[model samples]
Target: MTILNNKESMRVTLKSVTVPSIPLAALLVIACSGLWFSSYWGARLALFPNQTTEIVNHLQKIIVPNTLLSEIISFFLTLLNAFLLAQINNKFTIIRTRTFLPILVFMTLMGTWNETHLANGSHISLTLFILSLFSFFSMSRNRNSSEQAFMGSFLISISSILINPLIFLIPVCWIGFGMFQSLSLKTFLASLMGGLTPWILYLALNFIINPHFNVLQALILNPNFVLDISTYSLPDLVYFALMSIIIIMGIVGLYSTAHSDAIDTRNKLNFLVFLLISLCVICFIFINQFVSFLPIIALVYALLFSHPLTLKQNNFHSILFIVFCVINLVYAVSKYILT
Candidate 1:
């Protein structure tokens, strides 16, 4: 009771600390340091090949010193993704306080020493994916802006797939989200045209590159699906489990509070977007591309999961929050030391 009575006590929670940039700056230090722990430093782009290898290869040629270049590009792209998610929070009031929890949660996930930082196709794809979400959410308020939002999201999603074909299913999710957001027939047709436009350009490029190139094989059946999580160590598994639980809790908390009149149309629409992305990530988690997909989930996790911490004062919630932070910190430190 005394702790709650204190004015500073509220500021001690995870939700509060994320509101300021200082904590996120410290998190960046810890995250970037952990990135150096592995054999990844100065590692060539596409450490291994995938659907996007050709594009990454072209970048490697133009960029010079593929490893550092990829890292720098991916890192800043990640920052932009984080900032965009924060703006979504601001636009939709996803979190009660305008906090940079999206970035903090992303950095926390990155701290797990996952291969999310390899400056690969996934990063580029996720960068575009975040931009797509930004465009999609802008459709919340203005019907007049829906066409731009629809076209922008479609173009971004198409470009993302050109790099990482595993996310080819995402445009369907986007369309579903658009319909959920009260999309008009005209916007729906516009989305179709927007998604199709990328393939037209891709085929044109392919035609110029190699006349013998098989357009069908190039476009279809390009994604490789690998379902294996056994490579994760015990600590990785533990952290994964805890984070998954937190996400489920966050979604449930948001749903429970959805009926409140205080929440508006835009917030509800944004929540639908969160739910859509979460489902898509779960469906594709078995693939190698899943690592890049984690940050998107992290953004949703921070938005939905922070609700309980902000609303509840119980000991269990407090303990859970502490454990979430500690688990990440310890896993990151141990991974850095052991590796």
Candidate 2:
């Protein structure tokens, strides 16, 4: 446990073990730890079926099970998202130090899912968003991969939109990234085509079955935003407070290094942080209108928050890091006991 006190040791622990996905295994164990609180764990599935397309609605029904299997599958999906996120960070040298973003993501998730949870369509779209980001990032310095990257990014974005119509704003961010990467017209066109392809096929099938079904109307009129966070209880507020503090610390850490890092690295990381915060803003203000998008923010927060731990910035970061962990874990345990 002393590794928790040192940055280098923590980095090695995450980076050295990937073959068997030790980080993911550890996350699973932590997620399953909620079983002890199962009595208090209510069904907290956040699904907006009316806003979703038929394809995603069917998926929602099938993906959500009342049994323990749903939790296992949800955790697995979360791990996949974390792994993909870590891959992006490593490939682009975002954090530089080889730290596991998944662990950070899991810890943030613990605050949300301790009492009740579900791997809803919103969570599923998050994974798709990560895949789209992976494709977008893969095109960073490789011109030859532009078409594939753009196509994949668009395809995933479109799919995610179908699942959670609220994510329709994300493609704009992708377009911004495409511009930042200096994408070619062909690549841009390819992305547009890729996004349209799903709709084309879906409409074609729908027309054959139901002549009155209008894809355009479906696209234009689906999402109904429900904006209310007042229902959040005391425990929820405490969890949010802890998460916010961590994110603030992470932002401070990243800001401190902005001018010191290499230009290209700083620019890329800044763009990513900007895009993540943009998405979070959108999620909070419009789309999700809830803390459901904390996982997405958690991924970005983990990356930035991790920067402070990579260097020996006095013992302040170490103290803060340990304190944060202890608070969250203690909160989880105490919540379970009291419930």
TM-score versus the correct structure, for each prediction? 0.76, 0.75
The runs of at least 3 residues in candidate 2 whose Cα sits more than 4 Å from the true structure, single-residue gaps closed, are 1-52, 107-111, 114-117, 141-145, 169-187, 220-229, 287-292, 330-339
Which prediction has the highest TM-score against the true structure? 1
Cand. 1 TM to true fold: 0.76
Q: Write down the lDDT that model 2 would get.
A: 0.58
Cα RMSD, model 2? 5.2
* Local distance difference test, each candidate: 0.57, 0.58
- TM-score for candidate 2, please give it: 0.75
Error of 1 at 225 (Å): 5.6
* Candidate 1 stretches greater than 4 Å from native: 1-12, 21-53, 60-66, 141-146, 166-171, 174-180, 222-226, 261-286, 310-315, 334-338
* Candidate 2 per-residue C-alpha lDDT over 248-283 given as tens digits, one digit per residue, 9 for 90 to 100: 776677778777776556766676667666766666
